[model samples]
Target: MAAKPRVATCSLTGCFGCHMSLLDIDERIIDLIGLVDFDKSPIDDIKSFTGPVDVGIIEGGVSNDENVEVLRSFREHCGVLVAVGECALTGGVPSMRNLVPLKECLEEAYLKGPTLVGGAIPNDPEIPLLLDRVYPCHEVVRIDYMLPGCPPSADVLWTALAALLKGEEPKLGYELIKYD
Candidate 1:
């Protein structure tokens, strides 16, 4: 028998709704498991790549140094890199900060927020350095495919994954495109 394709996934600066949509595939996940081996994905809580992957599904935009690191690693380790959801495609809701200066944004969140009694802007080395602005995945790296949605519907994700595993392009119809 032929070896099943290997897949990996990661989420960056978005709400992680895309990953939720993947889980919404429910019982179909068993079929997917039989067709591909997952590597470096939250689905299996694998933190690092074990080997090269045939496909890498990434959700969310790049917003910080850590996100950049992970995204570069994904590109280096996977044959095809797919950007999933509005965030990965266009920076989504987080791009709202693009209208404001990063310094002001950080101050508001860390020092001047309404919900704070006494808080200071974080300066620890452990916190990843924030980028000046959020950036879509394609802006930072070559993306083989893109799925646009706040969270692409489970059916859309399933269809895309199925097609990619079969070495075919995902042909999403109008009905499968959904914002909610």
Candidate 2:
């Protein structure tokens, strides 16, 4: 028997909707589990990569120094790196902040917001610093594939994963692909 392919997944700057969509694949995930082993994913509650993986699926945009480091590490450790969802492919809604200056964005949240009493923009060494603009994962690393959607449908994810695991390109039908 062949060794099962190992897949790792991570989320950066978006809602975890992409991961939710993955779970929507339902019982098909059992078939996937039989073919591939999961590593370094929120699904397994693993926070760090334990070994090199055959595939890396990254969700969300790069909006902070930490995201860049994580993405780069994924690139280094995975044979194939896939950007999942609009955030990871094109920065999605988080890119809206690109139209505004970072300083003003921070001020609106910490100092000028009506809900705050004594909130201050945190600049602690322990906290990850925000980047000037949200960027797609590919802008930071060489992504081998991109699955685009607000949250890519479960069929789209499964098809892509299955194809890639078999060393073939994913072929998506019109219904499986979405721009919105």
Candidate 3:
């Protein structure tokens, strides 16, 4: 018998809603585990990629230098890369900042916002530097597939993974794909 395919997931610059949606598949996750061996995923809480991944599901836009590095690493190590959710596909809500200068956005959040008494824009060596604009995963690395939605429904994720596991095109129904 053959080993199950290796799967990994990562979240970069969006809310964790997409990972939650994957969990929304609920009990079906047992079936998913039976088909694929999860590698580096938040669900597993594994911090580093352990081995070559067969499928890498990325769940956020790239908004900083660290994001770029991680996405590129995924591209290097995964056989198939999936950009899941509106954030991963198009930068989604995070891209709203593209309309404003990055400096102004940082200033508002760190220095000038009403919440602060004496806050200054953080200039720590440990902090990841923000990029000029939020970018989709594809802008940072090659993406083999895209599952688009604010948070792709559990059905969409399941169907896509099932087909990919079987080495077939993910034939999503019109209703399963949404952009809003």
Candidate 4:
């Protein structure tokens, strides 16, 4: 029997709505489960993947220094990387705040403002300090494919998943966020 393709997935710097939307595929995901072996899906239980996966799905923007590393790592590990949400493709709503300076934004949040103690500094280096702008995933690293929607509709995700599993490029040329 041929080896099933492996897939890795992650969310970098945005709300996890896109990840949750994958569940919108209902039992169709069960069909997909048979086609590919997910190596690093955040929804699944795992940590630190180094496998040579066939596809990688990134679902958020590159909002800081760490996001840069995440994008690069995914690119290095996966053969075909797919940016799977508006945040991953065009930076989505998070990129809108790119117009503001980082210091002023921080000031407005903690110092001379509304939050409790005015400020509390974290000591961890992994914690992002904030940048002048938010970058989409592809801007930080090469993306083999992109699906642009705040949270792309389930049909779009399912179709993309199926095509990808079949070793064909998925076309995300249609809209996926409307329901009437």
All candidates: TM-score: 0.95, 0.97, 0.97, 0.90
Q: Model-by-model lDDT, in order?
A: 0.93, 0.93, 0.92, 0.80
Worst ten in a row by lDDT for model 4: 171-180
Tens digits of lDDT, candidate 1, 53-145: 999999999999999999999999999999999999999999889999999998999889899989899989999999999999999999999
What digit string (tens of lDDT, one per residue) describes model 2 on residues 1-180? 887899999999989999999999999999988999999999998888889999999999999999999999999999999999999999999999999999999999999999899989999999999999999998899999989888999989999999998999988888988956
Better of 1 and 3 by TM-score: 3
lDDT agreement of model 2 with the native = 0.93
What is the Cα-based lDDT of residue 178 in candidate 2? Answer: 92
**Model 1 backbone overlap count:** 0
Clashing residue pairs found in predicted model 2: none
For model 2, where is the 10-residue window of minimal lDDT? 171-180
User: For residues 29-119, could you state the per-residue lDDT of candidate 3 as single tens digits?
Assistant: 9999899998888999988899999999999999999999989988988999999999999999999999999999998998898879998
Error of 4 at 135 (Å): 0.1
- Between candidates 3 and 4, the TM-score winner: 3
Which of the two, 3 or 4, has more lDDT? 3
The parts of candidate 4 lying over 4 Å away from their true place are: 118-123, 173-180
* Model 1 TM-score on a 0 to 1 scale: 0.95
